[model samples]
Target: MTRRIRPRPRPKPHPHPLQLYSLRDICTIRILRFASSPELLEQYTNASGGLRTGMLMEHLDSLAGSIAYKYMLGPEVETLGRVQERGFYIVTASVERLDMLAPLYPVRDIRLSGQVICTGKSSMEVAVKMEALNPNRREETLMLGRFSMVCRNASTHKAHPVNLLIINTREEKVLFKMGESARNRRKYAALHSLSRVPPSSTEAAELHSTYLKYGQDDESLALGDRVWMGDTLLEKTMLMFPQERNIHQKVFGVYTYQLGFANSCLFTRSHVSFLSLDGIAFRQPVPIGSILRLRSQIIHTSPPGQLPAAVHVRVQASVVDVQTGQEEPTNDFRFTWTRDDGQTVPRIVVPRTYQEAMLWLEGQRALKMGTQIRGSRLQGRDR
Candidate 1:
């Protein structure tokens, strides 16, 4: 992919603090830790008196940016002036993984921390953890997320090299390996995505069996055993504003994530706990002032089981040009949620069209991979 490169002018005598340090220096200063007061949590709560997942996502994105900036810029040193004088911009490329281990309540104070765990030439992987604490109590981890960010020249929008991460401690080394594994998994999944190639023989056979089991005809639709593809789908449109743009003058990836996640939660309309978010791929950059159309659909639901049923939803965001009447995809998000009541509903999505079937199958693949990844992480932690 070719990126536009713009020429950057020489920095003036005074440069911003963001341009000062590398990841090494930034890690020492604890640049990615943020604390929110209980009052602040109260302000962010929804009508149901619970903290919204969208708000948490917004904070995670910001924390990821801070870590990326520090990794790219270096630590503040007055005597050394500025480590790198040229100002650069960083934007989220993708959110590889975000798992909500526990829900955050309004009574608890929130704390977030992020650090650069892996880096390429111009891209870095940031691991962000969110914790909640009650009055005079120890902190408990609520959620964890990983973000991939790319640095670019402020003017040209082309990729820029970032400082390499220095691994010293055994823990840091392990984290670095984890990040590398995540990156490799992402790459492999992308290369094997259904969008890139046709399904294998086994996958094709599975699809055929799925169609035979759940495919609805006119008579079946009337029986109410199946729901229309349009019935469970939800869509929202909003204009991207400058206030939500990042330093790169483009809409922040997290803003789109917040919109998609909130809409999915609303559509489910059940007391559901956030499980995981995966396959979040940013296809294109959303320009400021553009109209964004977000569409979400319940693609799959868990079978009848003793545990709470899991529902998988897919959200796609596209940029619409009002004058030209053209729309292009910007990002794709897949989220998994489990019913809080532990009620298993034998709900299966019936795709009315071939396009819908493709989407449904894609969601199935994503959910399987997400489950595997979560299981592997748990095993690692236990070890």
Candidate 2:
């Protein structure tokens, strides 16, 4: 069947824009200083001796906040000001578009740098890069990513205005434009969400084909080289400890992210390298004294023969009510991982229901976009 619901129209841009801060004025850089301290370096290394990308992920959250506070507090400020006195505090709105440019090694120091590339009336976009600082060799960029942050009124809990950024140079203009494009892509994705709009003819036809091949309810379909998506899931249920809470009793986003990452790794069951983060939003955080059930699924995988084949995993963070035993979704995380040995995929994931089909298609879209980004970075080109 054809699509019964079409995408909504794009909103018009504001006529006159106010630009104030130069890209340089809001820039921030952090050095790991691991070269001098072996103990410090070990703290960031995983069991396989590779850098812990998971820890770095949480560090990015802190870095984003630090940059936002730096923008408002000016340079040379070493400590964050009290939120009560500042009248406002920054919170992470969403994490988006993280692509690994190269493998991170623990032998050298790494520099994390980013700046306020774009700003709205109450929102700001922070772009960050992680680079290996080589002493006698060329510096290698390890990662590139973006974070969306917003200032909130401490008392009112409403969106607060931030400093408007000024595009002073051509480079700054390019970054500002990229931020705008990212925002547009987010809107487009939401508009085409399966819940909001009907599937197109192509998607409908594909789902039908799958249904014909493997009947939905039949688990013993004698499937060869293929497995039901639900069978490839890993789940974990745990209580939020006091250390994980941030908002008095509400758990923060960092623990959710870490749990999601670990769940994906377990599902892969191999030495997988982080390819990219499709997206993660902190719409809601699981509260303390609540049971959190994190479900991770291998939604999509590359073809058998593609070198360095990857898998796309989606982790759903949900809170389970104790009394009624009902589940409430808190957040969803999308991640792409490549086999560290660069081996082809072993199996394919098949959706078993209409909802699974929609999630599978969404995973397909995220994988496609992530592949393009990773390709561009590896080829020394910008997308």
Candidate 3:
């Protein structure tokens, strides 16, 4: 009898802001085959074979948690409370799906896999791949997307160094490469827009006074040191339903904000570590089966000392009826970040106008309230 030596299982990696699963972990992935179960359709999704964007976003939240558990924390996800004063930013999000045929009998199935693609000094990049898992059938590529988040000091809301990711497998390497390329593209794009998008004179005035108000506030929460501006294209299949009561069924304000949060975070080279959402209101309704195009821009940044080193971003989602080529305003949201450091300051020039300032002030108020409400909702939903 010959004795053979077996290789030892690799030690579980240390905790880091950006972490990837090993090859063995990727190999063991069992593709999940999920369709709109009859119950699921009857309970939630519309009859046109399209689910609400909010519902889709909720699913992504669950998926994010799953990714966090499997890759970030191995067997036991560390206990980190709600995104309170410090946390990560959601930079971008998009649903990867196969084409819909007749809405009732959608063909392809999608399996989403996500991981931290890279780690900046104070930020982390995550990539998610939605692949069609058809064992015996041929299907087209579904969707590919990535997000960036920044971690902040829990107390000061200042930017701080975070642990780098440890990559060990081929699949992880591939995702990492893709993230690098995407980030590089972002840098190139930013270089051309070095000059700030000059705000109208009135807008400028508002920014100045708005800072004063935040400066006056005693309960300010800063999430990051910098503000970012960017755009993300979300591909969604909108199914038309003639029987529904309202022709325009607006997407949830909260959902669009969160999704924009993910994309903007990624664009800013930050993680979705700590966030507060507020003043979420659905102004109007969006018709069913409309591709909602979302655009977000970093309008301002507060330094780490004024409050917390954080970024102020404004986002807008517009629903486009692809068939008719008509668009309608769907949602508008504002997001703020608290740096990790205890020292909160102004990172960007605060606008200097009454109206613009008032708007900023309102956004701040809404963000505060939104953060509390959204955080609670996220926690409750998770549980």
Candidate 4:
């Protein structure tokens, strides 16, 4: 794909305790000449003729990394250079969230942009945005997301400090604060994660209520229009290909994101509309040739509303050790989806096991947050 990069330059050096960078100094804008090239849009179009969100995610991941690397390696450098020679490499630590703002029309030219808005001792918060350009030169926001990236020393495999951001304007402070808040939230969420502690009392009570309603049926098991979470699983297994490899020669996280979106569609058997993706954590780097297993499940369902219901799904990406027969999980993806308004799902998702119950609660949390976010956006727009 041909790209038109927005011009940028760095007035600083090319070393460790890197120079202070303005937010604009690290910004990267890529124009996908879709309107000019009709032939290239076929691969990125979904079966329904809309832009494929999974493909957009791949671009976001790539753009975020490019912005991060530019921050560390300066704008004059076009390539990642040599990993070992450069001393450090960038990796996605986690994705805070990605929200669909407007419909992504397939025929429109899209612009992808990202910049390092905030930085820590070693980590950076890269904010990415997607906009669809119209014939009159108007742009509509299509998607917005934040990526947490960290640098690692190539030799020691330890956290490597990156170039600092020199926050100048009020807008820059707001962006920086958002990143700071996200980091704090991650720390808080990790502490309260199900792996480290039991469910809260309120969550336990909710799970008990679910058990009384769904688990009491001994014969049909699903006495009502609700199915066990275990029954809603869909899996995809594939070998990591060289084409999906990132700058570090590791399978890109975007592949996992795409797999999750595709698998979620199969779970519902519909052309699901995307709402949001949250709480993505990349635990391990998958080698280019590793075998990948993606397990997707419907973890939560909001009670039927005007739209019938909203499904909250989770996909776990794992790498299988061919020799030892071991499956080590590498990432977790949470997404929210629904069909067009007024359509209803056949059944609600219910958790029977304690483990699944915990996941149910986590998905519930994500759904609630996504709803609030969209609600606030709508409110702001209405004003």
- Candidate with top TM-score is 4
TM-score (all chains, Cα) for each model:
0.81, 0.86, 0.40, 0.90
- How do the candidates rank by TM-score, highest first? 4, 2, 1, 3
Off by more than 4 A, model 2: 1-19, 205-224, 245-269, 287-290, 321-326, 380-383
Compared to the true structure, candidate 2 yields what TM-score?
0.86
lDDT of 3 by residue, 130-192 (tens): 456566765433333345544554445566454546677786787678667656755653463
Model 1 global lDDT (CA atoms, 0 to 1): 0.70
Cand. 3 Cα-lDDT: 0.45
lDDT of each: 0.70, 0.78, 0.45, 0.81
Give per-residue CA lDDT, model 4, range 1-383, as digits (tens).
88989879866553466778888787899988777787788777777787778778888889999999889989888988789988899899999989887777777889999888889999999999998889876677778889999999898899998887898999899889988988898899899988899988888898888777666666545345678889887788899889888777888655555655665565555667888887688899889999999888889877645353577888888999999989999988888887654466656678878788889999878888888877776576556
Candidate 1 has its poorest 10 consecutive residues by lDDT at: 27-36
lDDT of 4 at 222: 38
Return model 2's CA RMSD, one decimal.
9.3
Model 2: pairs clashing at backbone N, Cα or C within 3 Å: none
Per-prediction tally of clashes = 6, 0, 82, 0
Model 3 / residue 330 / CA error / Å: 14
